[model samples]
Target: MSKREMKIKPVIDRTFTDCMEQLQEGYVCAVAATAGCTVEALRRDLFGGDLLITRDGKTAHDQEVSLLLQLKNTTTVRPDPDKETFSYQLKKREYFDRLAAPRKHPKLLLVVMTTSPNQTEWTKGTHDSLEVQYCCYWRSLEGEQAADGVQKPTVRIPTRNVFDAVALTDILDRLDRGEELT
Candidate 1:
C-alpha cells in the first residue's frame, strides 16, 4: 500500500472535551469566589471534573441536575427563533418544575446557550435574572475574541455543533459524584 493509503485518520472525540474544558474553568472561577481567593490560586487541573463529591454534602444539598439546564438550536425541537427572547422565561419555568422549586432558589447553575441575534436580544433584557448568566453563540460557538483576551467567555454545552446527550450525562454524573468541575 502507498504511504497515503497507509495513513490513519484521527477521529474527533465529540464526547465533549472542548465544552468540558470550558465548564471546568467556569467551575474553578465559581469555586474561587466561594473560597475567597483569586481564581488563579486554584490549580488548572483541579477543574478536571474528576473529583468525586459526595451526594450528601452541604454544597450538594438540594442540588438538582436539571438546574444545569441547556437550551440549544436542535434539529427539530429547537426553541422558536421568533420567540427567542422568551426562551429564558420558558427554561426558568421548566427548571422550576423539574426541580420542584422557584427559580431564585436553585441550588445548581442555570445556563442558557443560543446563537447570535437570539443571545443578543435576550441579553438586552437586563431585568431578567436568567439572562444575567447568558452565554452567546459568538462566545461559545463562533469562538470570538473577547475584549479581555486572556479570559474569553465560554458557552456551556456538551459540544460545539451538536448537543451530545451521553457526554452531558457523564459530566453530570461526575458533578453528582462531587467532582470539582473546575
Candidate 2:
C-alpha cells in the first residue's frame, strides 16, 4: 500500500476523565502552594480520597488542620432550575459512605467541571498567562447518610462553594479554629 493509502492510528493511554483529574489536581496544587499549604497525593484508588491538604505553618497552640479530598471530574453535572446548586452522581455508594463518615480529618468532594466538552479546549497557554477552562466546586458530605442499597447516589453541591484559593484559605482557617465546615 502507498503511504497515502495507509491510515495512521494514534494510541492514547489516558482517558479524558484521567486527564481532567490530573489537571484539576495540578490546579489545586498551584493554589495550595500560593496559599502556603501543602498537598500530598494518596495512593491511587486505594483510599477513598485523592489528595490531602494541610496548612504549612503550625503555631504552638494551633493543631494541624488537614482536609481529605475526593476528586471527581465530570462533564454531565446538571445545574438546578434555580441555578443555586448542581447535582453530580457518585459512581460508588461505598465511596460516598466513606466520605460521609466522620473522621479526625474532615473530608470533601471536589468536582471539576469542564466548560467545554472538547478536551483540547480545556486549557490554553500563552507567554503571559495560562488559562484553564474549568471550575471546581466543593461539598462536605460529613455526617450525611447514603441511600440504602443504592450503588450510585446523586449529591447536590451549592453554587457558592467554589473551590478557589479564597475558599481553600477559608476552609483551612475554619478547621484551624476548630470550626466545622457546613
Candidate 2: worst-modelled 10 consecutive residues by lDDT: 4-13
For model 1, the superposed segments whose C-alpha errors exceed 4 Å read 1-13, 17-21, 24-84, 88-96, 100-109, 115-182
Q: On residues 1-182, what C-alpha lDDT tens digit does candidate 1 reach at each position?
A: 65632332213335333443354445434433443323332233222112222222236455544213222221112344344232222222332233222233112332334322222232243454323233322012212222343232322333232223333444446555655332
Which residue pairs show backbone clashes in model 2?
none
TM-score of 2: 0.83
Residue pairs that clash (backbone atoms under 3 angstroms), model 1: 47-182, 51-179, 53-177, 53-178, 53-179
What's the C-alpha lDDT at position 154 in model 2? Answer: 81
Task: Give candidate 2's whole-model lDDT.
Answer: 0.74
lDDT score, candidate 2, position 32 = 81
Q: Which candidate achieves the best TM-score against the true structure?
A: 2
